[model samples]
Target: MEYVLVLYIEQALKKGVVQTMEMGLAEMGRVLRQRVLLIVLVTLLAVGLAGAGSFLVLEPEYEATTTLLVQSKQTEKGIAYNDLLTDQKLVTTYGEIFQSRMIAEAVIERLGLDLTEQELLENVRVRSSSESLLTAVTVTDHDPKQAVTIANAMAAVFMENLGRIMQVDNVSILDTAKLTSDVLEPVRPKPYLNMAVALVLGAMAGAGLALLLAFLNNTVQTEAEAEQLLQLPALGAIPFFEQKGSSGYRVVVRQDPRSAVAEAFRTLRTNIQYDEAGKHVKVLIVTSTLAGEGKSMVLANLAVTMAQAGKRVLLIDGDLRKPTLHHVFHLGGQIGLTEVLCEGVAPEEVILPSAAGPDVIPAGAIPANPSELLGSPKLRGLLSDLRIRYDLVLIDSPPLLPVTDGQVLSTLCDGVLFVVRSGEVARDQLQQAKGLLERVGAQVIGAVLNGKQRKRSEPAYSYYAAPEGDPHD
Candidate 1:
């Protein structure tokens, strides 16, 4: 039993290792797939740079080769196997002697070449074929004529010295050193091969860098990230929309009702209506961690969408410090929220109708103390009164981190819809924003991930398609 249990444990360990390896491979594939464009662009640039450097930076070297046949001197008896074996052995020895300092010095003196023995030997190479008694000596130099001259002189000097040094005089020249007209093109520094290697290296470097950046980036980028970081459900993910020609203050849902941007708001409307605490969430305040997060834009568009669905929606600009509803709605911001709060103006007087959709009440004027005004008792009473008249009251408040206006308004509202700009708010900042709302006893119903751009490779959603009736896969 003990032996069987140990065997089982070994199997389990092997299975676990395999699973871990599979997981690692999957992760690598994901990283490479997502950053393929960056890798390709970097690889192309590297290949161009390497090819250009090979041509412009590296020194050119020309080569000249001399082949020789090694044999025994003519004998009365026919050449024997032993003689062939001995000649083959001497071929290797002669190869070494071809590059020796003695032969290099002789060749330099005989050819009047201006080079030291070491430098001359460094430029020369000799190789002996294993299957034959053939030795080839090659010389490389910047000048093609000099390389040929050195190679031929080295071979001649080796033949002359062989008889004196080893008493063997059977060396025969098979081919003299020669070069073609195209000797200017060097054999080393192959540009095409260098570029190919550079491309692969650059691709690897780019992919590694992309993976590192993705791992280090701690910003909220997707709906999943927003929900995971903030501990709240993702209410909606709004796609980024580019403003085209003839740009004016108009809600995208009203101007281009068939656009994806308009569909996103409508989806947001359905989500809000079906949320766990949504039935009682009539007064919803829209705010984000910081300014320029598109919370105000989302609020305005959502208000327009809800109104188009025949709901009585009241769009109020609660950001008194820096009001933009007037600009968005193309209405006068002279008399609105401020007039109603300080002067006790009638709600109907400040609440004006928009040509596109919804009734908008712009922040009248910039207040010196926005937090104080929002935290007043009358503001809460005003919201309560508006809730009774309108089916839904959507307030576009200031960002939570910059001011206390949104937090104070959160206390009065039924629910808060936190908006996060994808890739804009860091994880730590989003966490802090959520903590602040929770500390104030605010009911954060859900979060909206705004300005998310869809990748080009993703398939398009059929907005006009009919729903399928099938329930099973």
Candidate 2:
């Protein structure tokens, strides 16, 4: 039981991370845009740190350099100095005297420093150039005056220590170390260079994080995702329409009647006609996983498209809760479906003619029991009567997952069409909606993607949603 409980907790945490990553990838472009201000602020902060940290943390320490001269005595011919070739042999001895603790201790004592011989040695450096007997000693300290004093003291002590240790007077300081009266500048923390490094590092980090998120994410954001998830052939893609006017609403077959939008609907119409199993599509229902998915608008435009093709299309405003079909056609909602059911009006009579719309039944009043009304026997009978009167019946339903209205109506319809807004409906939510329809045995033919982005690289599928605003789907 404990092992099972631990497994359950681990699964839960994994699910949370997966969900977050999926959401990020699904909205990758929008997420990048949203973080623009944050990226700018981070760059500014890096610059400020580069500038302020450079000035305070750096301390100046001056260095004093002095060279020692040693010449080898050698001659090709007979000479007194030729017999005494001792300068070359004295090089190592001279180098050791400059580095010895005794010489360093004497220098510190003469210069009046309270530091130990080891501490004094830390400030002194002795070395020779390549193939040369010239020894160089350098002393560094916080003040220029003190650095010069230590350098001269160490040089004087090195000569004294060399005569005693090597038993020869072969070493001497060529020049005395002195103070220049000017303070040496500190060298540390280059602000410009630091800022540049930070910029490069920060950009690389951001890019790595973005790629990691993109790879791990699995939410449905593309039209390709919908096609792959449902395993259905894509029918057609409708461009997002902003409003109901000339520029808005892509059902150009209904509005413009001669443009590309009209062309797309005709293509969709052709696909529907070619479906052998779904060829007898009469009473069709359109719905989505959530509201604001443009189900009503798509329904209106599809009906309009069929009507233009010389088919008697009947558009029904089946969303009894929040009826928008009535407003779109500017029709009189004085009496509609509720009145037809209660007042016993003929199904044909409730079907009103529109000025531009083919035929529509406006939702007269807000019904209390929407699911019940849709599930009633009258709805099927009404559909049968309308099927004979009109060539096609288009039923606009509420969101599938939000209510059971679409589910109840689906049983009576010939087939159902699900509308999914790209980037708006989460992958899991759509999966849930699909599961609900399957449980109820609804025949979902294919999905209609409503709003699509303008990006060319984006795959052609149902719809595309961005962070800016609603792409109709």
Candidate 3:
């Protein structure tokens, strides 16, 4: 039983390793796809540099080779098989001798070349096959004729020294190095091979850089990440969209009621309406970790969607410092929340009707003290009064981390709906916002992931035409 348990544990560990590898590969593929342009640019730059170096920067080198045949002197027995094998073995030894300093110095001296023995040896190469009785000596230089001269000179000098060093004169020249008018091609600086290698290396470097950048990025990019970091349920994912030739705030649910963005708002509305804990939530505050995250736009559209669903909804621009609900609804912002709270103005007089099917209350005039006014007893009483007048009251508050207005408003609201823009707010900022709200004893119902990047391959939400009554009819 113990052995069986150990085997089970071993299988589990193997499965875990396989899963880890698969996840790593998936993350790498995602990074590669997102940074393909960077990789391509890097590869092209490397190829260009390689081409420039190969053609213009580096000097060309030419190679010339000379071959020598080693054999036993003819005797009564033409040549024994053993002697042939001995000669073949000697060919390898002769190859090393051909590249020795003595041969290099003699070749340099005979050619009147100004180079050290080591320098000349560096440019020389020798090769011999164990199965054959032939050795080849090759020399490389900048000039084709000079390479041919050095190679032939090295072979002759080696042949002259072979008799005295080994006391055998059986070596003969097989092929002398020669340069024809058409065969003066340089063997160095292979442009195609260099460029190919540079491209591969550059791609590898770019991919590594891309992975590092992805690792360092701390923004909440996906709905799942936002949920995990903020510890909130994702109510809806709003897809990003652009309207050509339009500006300012847009009420997608009111204007283009059939768009994916509009449907997303409807989904959010349904989730909030049927939420087990949020069903009775009357006053909900919508805010984010920072400004410019589209929280105001989300709240505006959400109010319109609720009104369209046969519910009485009141949209309040609680962000007095930077109110946008009036601009969104095209309503006059002369007298609204500020006037009602500070000026003792009647709420009925300042409450304006919007074409978007909701009662709108703009931010009115900018106040020197928004935090003080939001936390006043008058604001709390106004919200309590509005709670009885409307089925749902949605407030647009400022970002939590930037000011205490959202936090103060959250204390009065029944629930808070956090709006997070993808790739805009970092995970730590979300955590901070969550902590601030929790400290204020606020009820965070859920979160809306706004501006979510949608892939083209993912099927869009659209109504397909139903089949007409059977063709048999």
The best candidate in terms of lDDT:
3
What is candidate 2's local distance difference test score? 0.72
Tell me the lDDT of candidate 1: 0.84
Global local distance difference test of model 3 = 0.86
Off by over 4 Å in 3: 1-62, 71-97, 100-102, 105-120, 129-133, 141-146, 161-170, 178-210, 243-247, 461-473
TM-score, candidate 1, is 0.79
**Models sorted by lDDT, best on top:** 3, 1, 2
Candidates 1 and 2 compared by TM-score, better number: 1
State the lDDT of candidate 2 residue by residue for 94-116, as single tens digits: 77777788887788778779889
lDDT of 1 at 103: 90
- What TM-score goes with each of the models? 0.79, 0.64, 0.80
Worst 10 residues of 2 by lDDT: 460-469
Model 2 clash pairs are: 449-462, 451-473
List CA RMSD, all candidates.
8.3, 9.0, 7.2
Ranking by TM-score: 3, 1, 2
- Model 1, range 1-473, lDDT digits (tens) per residue? 99998898677544332122233765667657778888888888899899888999877788998899998776789788889889988888898888788998898788887889999999988889757989988888888888898888988899899989999888999999875335467787789999989988998888887776665566787897789878889989888875333665557888777777888889999999988887789899999999889888899899988998899999899999888888888888789999888889988898989886789898997778888888899898999898889999999989998888888999989999999998898877888888888889999999999998776566565543324553431
* Runs with alpha carbons beyond 4 Å of true place in candidate 2: 1-188, 212-219, 244-263, 458-473
Give the true-structure RMSD of model 1. Answer: 8.3
